[model samples]
Target: MKRLVFILLLVFAGICCSCKNDDDGGCVGVDCLPPETQTGENTFGCLLDGEPFIPRGGVNPLDCVYQLIDGERYFNLEAAMNDAGFNEIAISITTNAKEIIENQTYSLVSEFEVGGVSGKYIFNGDIFDTDNQNSGKLTITHLDIDNQIVSGTFFFDVIDQNGELREIRDGRFDMKFTR
Candidate 1:
């Protein structure tokens, strides 16, 4: 009876180990985030107020757009997800700069101006943005214009019109850009 019990315990242990979550491509926990990569894997994720915010749905949840207006270049990176009630939540980072260079960091600002960056959070039709009272940083780790791939990391605090504050942290994205 002792030997049988010991064998049963070993089998249980083996089963528990095998059932552990080991998916590297998926978020692991409540505070889990997507892996930061320089390749254009169309991945985007962040932590919103300590909860994981990952883009969902089947079509174009992550997007990067590069445009040239009045001879000035600008880029917009956006990630969006749908909640349980089908409400859309999104985060957008836009830069009003002449050019985007690799290994450069941009400041999040309230107003749109030359060489300034802006961050926005939209949920249920309410928009919050980084203002003078709140700010954040976006660092471009890799930018390949020829291949149209861009990767970056960012974190910010934004305020809505009603003065509600939302903290976004550990943000990262790797995606292909469209010009």
Candidate 2:
């Protein structure tokens, strides 16, 4: 009976080891692909401090909000890395309808003034935003106004309130804007 019990324990161990409990930094869902891979609908990804930074929505949920204000189109994309407020990131891009066309490139400005395409990275205590000191570019690879599908790539450098600079690279977003 002891030998039989030992055998059962081994079987249970094997089963437990074979099960997959997939997750992405506490975010659950098949859409939560391993951070190394970056491709999804309504997805945004980049590298932060040489680590994969993929944004996800939780109970509060991330949003890709779009609006046409004063003849300019604004696209605001946000991702919550965690349930905590300090772990979120926001990217806002403003351009005219003509500038947002497919296969076009738009300049990313660090100015806090109007019509600036900027990025913000917020961590436990570190926060950074595009300022007039840095430069970046955004390329629109696809835009479907009828279906409201917008896809783009971007990279930028932002400065923290304390004057520290952080670079965000390999950024990509494929989102259907919510009007």
Candidate 3:
């Protein structure tokens, strides 16, 4: 019995020592986080869920990065960097949906996930209410720097804890962006 107790104490001490510091301010274990960046055209360098943060030289059609929490939306690196204090950030754009997703047309939505806590994003001409990191949108309008004069949607679906996608059904409504 004494040997067992001694072993357990040593194990606990080791676990306590293994925890690394998270300098990001907002998250614990922030350094363990993965960032997927869109580089070049329709390509990306990603080190995502369960994978080590190894920059994939380039992959086709980059998918938006996200994490799921109780049916609400959470933003990853891009969105987090866009506005740290501001939970939501709005940027007007002028382009089609396909163009924006491809990064061919500039956009302003970046986040890692959508739900444990809610963050807001304004896209096209509507506000998106994020639930469990699942639902949100991004919109753009005609701005002086760029002028396409079109509408687009930045929709998000909840992702399961295992890094799997949870299907979202279609609906029509105006979701509000808190920012």
Candidates' C-alpha lDDT: 0.84, 0.63, 0.29
Return the TM-score for each candidate structure. 0.79, 0.66, 0.19
Worst 10 residues of 1 by lDDT: 22-31
Q: Which stretches of candidate 2 lie over 4 Å from their true place?
A: 1-40, 83-86, 89-99, 123-127
Clash totals in order? 0, 0, 34
lDDT by residue for model 3 (1-179), tens = 99999999999999989877644434422233333222212211111222212112122112232223454323221221122343232321111112222222222233322212222323222334345445444432211113212222333444444455433221111111110
Predicted model with the maximum TM-score = 1
Query: Per-residue lDDT of 125-150 in model 2, one digit per residue for the tens?
Result: 46466656775777878777777777
Better of 2 and 3 by TM-score: 2
The candidate, 1 or 3, that scores higher on TM-score is 1
Better of 1 and 2 by lDDT: 1
Top of the candidates by lDDT: 1
